[model samples]
Target: MDDASDKYRAPALEKGLDIIELLANHGEGLTQRELAKSLDRSPNEIYRMLSTLVRRGYVIRSASGDHYSLSLKMFSISQRHPPIGRVIEAALPRMRSLTRKAWQSCHMGMESNGDIVIVATAESPGNWGLALKTGTVVGLWNTGTGRVLAAFRTPEEIDDLIARHRRAVGEPEVVRAEFDGHLARIRTAGYEKMPSATAVGVTNLAFPVFNPSGQVVAVLSCPYLERVDDLVVPPIDEVVEIYRTLANELTALYGGTNPFEKDLTP
Candidate 1:
């Protein structure tokens, strides 16, 4: 930033970092031309950097060789760092228990920058269940997990989050008023339950998990599916109750209080 810092700046390294940051915000990936135009650089300038990133496994070139996105390697590296890694370790077992009890797959997501990143996931005990992979970046406004995270935060924080948001691929656009009202409903209900925007016949259930300081640290979400002709599966209501309890236990594990005990006057 200063003259001395500017003098030591490595242009190539900066270009690579710029590319990574851009890709991080845009989960859908971008073409080289798009990346160059957005970064105010010529396509030729970034070609070598892109090639290097692809070689290092930090970026993935789409099958058509036209677009690039951040690879799991970057997310994997972040998971290896402290606190995040520990959080995933602490949540996976509980998530697994929830999946087993509810007979549905579940995932824990946290707000990263402006997107919801799936930090950990647990598959259902049954052979067939929907499960998102860890490290997947989902839309901030179009997902149950993302809404639960926003619903528990202050209005200012939510607005800031909205400002920084970049829509993921195929993420539907939500009007500001509708999004605000949706968050209000989530707050009043103390959780979120709605049909999946991206999948058919799946209802998403999400609850906020708080830290010791009463701030939401993450959200646990289950994509509920009714087994066809399987009468023994837990009912949707029962699954909701089980999932809520699991979220509470996770909050308690972080030394936080039950959000239901607090006034939720949205």
Candidate 2:
């Protein structure tokens, strides 16, 4: 290779990035031997790379021996970027409006590796409220947002997600059966409403936001207190309708050239 080409190339940097990308793409952590095999490198070479990554806080070793995974450092890196930042910014105003209209806490969440992560949230003005902060992570089987996101997935995908979580959390068989029933209802209703699995005396209303490919990329959710005297508690049917409208509007706004034209009729 020429001197200029040699000057531009950095084999060490490339190898480190390859390791990071592989860990990021995998749903589960990779053992040292697995990483070496995937990267076509020796264990010693992979160990040094992994050590540097661990020191830099880009990766962490699991409690179980020799396995490695990416860390919150990746989320910090994404927060500085414009694309995701802008999406959160644009969605906040609408999220706030929805919260005010329904008199409940509302959230904009996206599926990340089979978990629902809240990106934006608006708190209810009432004294009794459902408080879900941004960055809150919820199980794919427990919440309305989780169920709606799961509804868009294929059976194999859902099974994979359930199995992964079952290994991690050891959810009871009865709970799994109930969640399966919830998924069926979400598929039929085109939306999901369930008593809050994460919080007490609250109900979650969730609907999926589709991209231009008719794929569910995100979810919009409202967590409302189950109180009779609350003026902000809109009727269930109206709340569902409003959520459907908002999801359609968001699809149009972000759909770009691949405009989302999915049938959201419920």
Candidate 3:
């Protein structure tokens, strides 16, 4: 009665740390048996811990097969908490300025399950604007923002997205080919700009936002209408430059250095 309680204080905390460390050291994911062996724990213990991690969004089961790997929920948590929250809050003022200067609505979106979902939005200064509200889900095959997100993902992720979407939506080969072609262009251009997927005569110009490790985490986009042949203001070059500058600013603010700075120029 005077010994056991003091010695075994928190098994749950220890189990969580063990699972994290095991996954970190393994690089490639481990099955329950392997994880158990590495941690010197029983398979049942490891399985329970893994199940919890998966439920909490800290781990994800591989789509290609049965395996577990770290998820970006940790990143999402960091973005939500302080320090990083301050940075994102500061970045919004600049996003608003860019939106006004370009006479276009702007959106910030992050990739989730292969789709891009808008998390923030700023309206154009003009009375008439092409606006996309926060939480708008962009299709991977059709939008500029979606293309940037798709381009930055790993090949396996791209394949998995395509496969899953195809199964769910029954997309034809022509649609797949079109998306592939857009992806190739995004890689070539180092950014994505195209006519709006959902609205007629509007265009979207987008650049990818990267983290310190050079992984694209989100995208910044401006939605605007194409000017008539007589108009000269808000040139495409100027808008692209603004997008690039915002991308760089966000990168630096978040402790990330730009890897595509040299490649971004026309």
Candidate 4:
């Protein structure tokens, strides 16, 4: 190799990054021996690398001292980037607008670290709305927003994310497979309107928000509730149609294409 090539190479940094990416893809984690075997390095060589990664807060060691996994540090770091900021910036107003239109609470979330994290939320105008605060993280398999986000990704990406979500929720592999099928159905339907897995008497309505490449960058979801109000609440079916408009509007605001539009073409 040339001197210039040697100068640009940082072997140690590369090894550390390799470990991080592997753990991220795996989600559950790997043992030190497993990491070494996967990386084609000696355990002792990788031990120092793991130690450095753990100390720098990029990775965490289990209490057993035999396994390793990624910490949330990287996910936190990603939230500070411009793309995430722009997504949040472009989402809040739309979230509120959709909420006001339907008189239901809505939230926006994106997948991170094997979970769907609520980044912004707008409550229904009165005190009768369902409210989930910002920074709340929910499993990817059960939430409507989670399914919408999952439905838009490639199969490989879905597999990886579901594996992690399964580990997080401790659900059975059979359930995981069912969740995969559920996402496929959601893709065909172009939206998800179902009962909340965690809360009762509330229906979850979710739509996908896309980036310029038509990849789902975020999910806009609302928990639909009926109140004994002054007879002005939109029915659940109308709420679903309204969310469709909001999804298309937000997708266009970000210069994103709606994949379902192509499915609808004659």
- Which model scores highest in TM-score? 1
Model 3 global lDDT (CA atoms, 0 to 1)? 0.74
Best prediction by lDDT: 1
Candidate number that wins on TM-score, 3 or 4 = 4
All candidates: CA RMSD (Å): 4.4, 8.8, 12.8, 7.9
Residue 192 lDDT (model 4): 80
What are the lDDT figures for the candidates, one per model? 0.87, 0.74, 0.74, 0.81
Model 2 regions lying over 4 Å from their true place: 1-74, 80-83, 163-177, 230-233, 256-266
* Per-prediction TM-score to the true structure, in the order listed: 0.80, 0.63, 0.62, 0.67
Residue ranges of candidate 1 with Cα displaced over 4 Å: 1-10, 21-71, 261-266
Which prediction has more favorable lDDT, 2 or 3?
Answer: 2
- List model 1 lDDT by residue over 188-258, tens digit each: 88989989988899999888888888888889899999887745888899988888887888888778886
Ranking by lDDT: 1, 4, 2, 3
Q: Compared with the true structure, what per-residue lDDT tens digits does model 3 show for residues 86-130? A: 546866789888877887778877666555567777887776677
Off by over 4 Å in 3: 1-87, 163-174, 227-232
Q: Positional deviation of 1 in candidate 1, in angstroms?
A: 12
lDDT of 2: 0.74
lDDT of 2 by residue, 129-220 (tens): 77677776666777777788888778898887666542113222337677788888887777777787666777788877776667777788
Pairs of residues at least 3 apart in sequence or in different chains that clash in candidate 3: none
Q: What is the Cα-based TM-score of model 2?
A: 0.63
lDDT of 4 by residue, 181-222 (tens): 888788887878788887789899888888898798888888
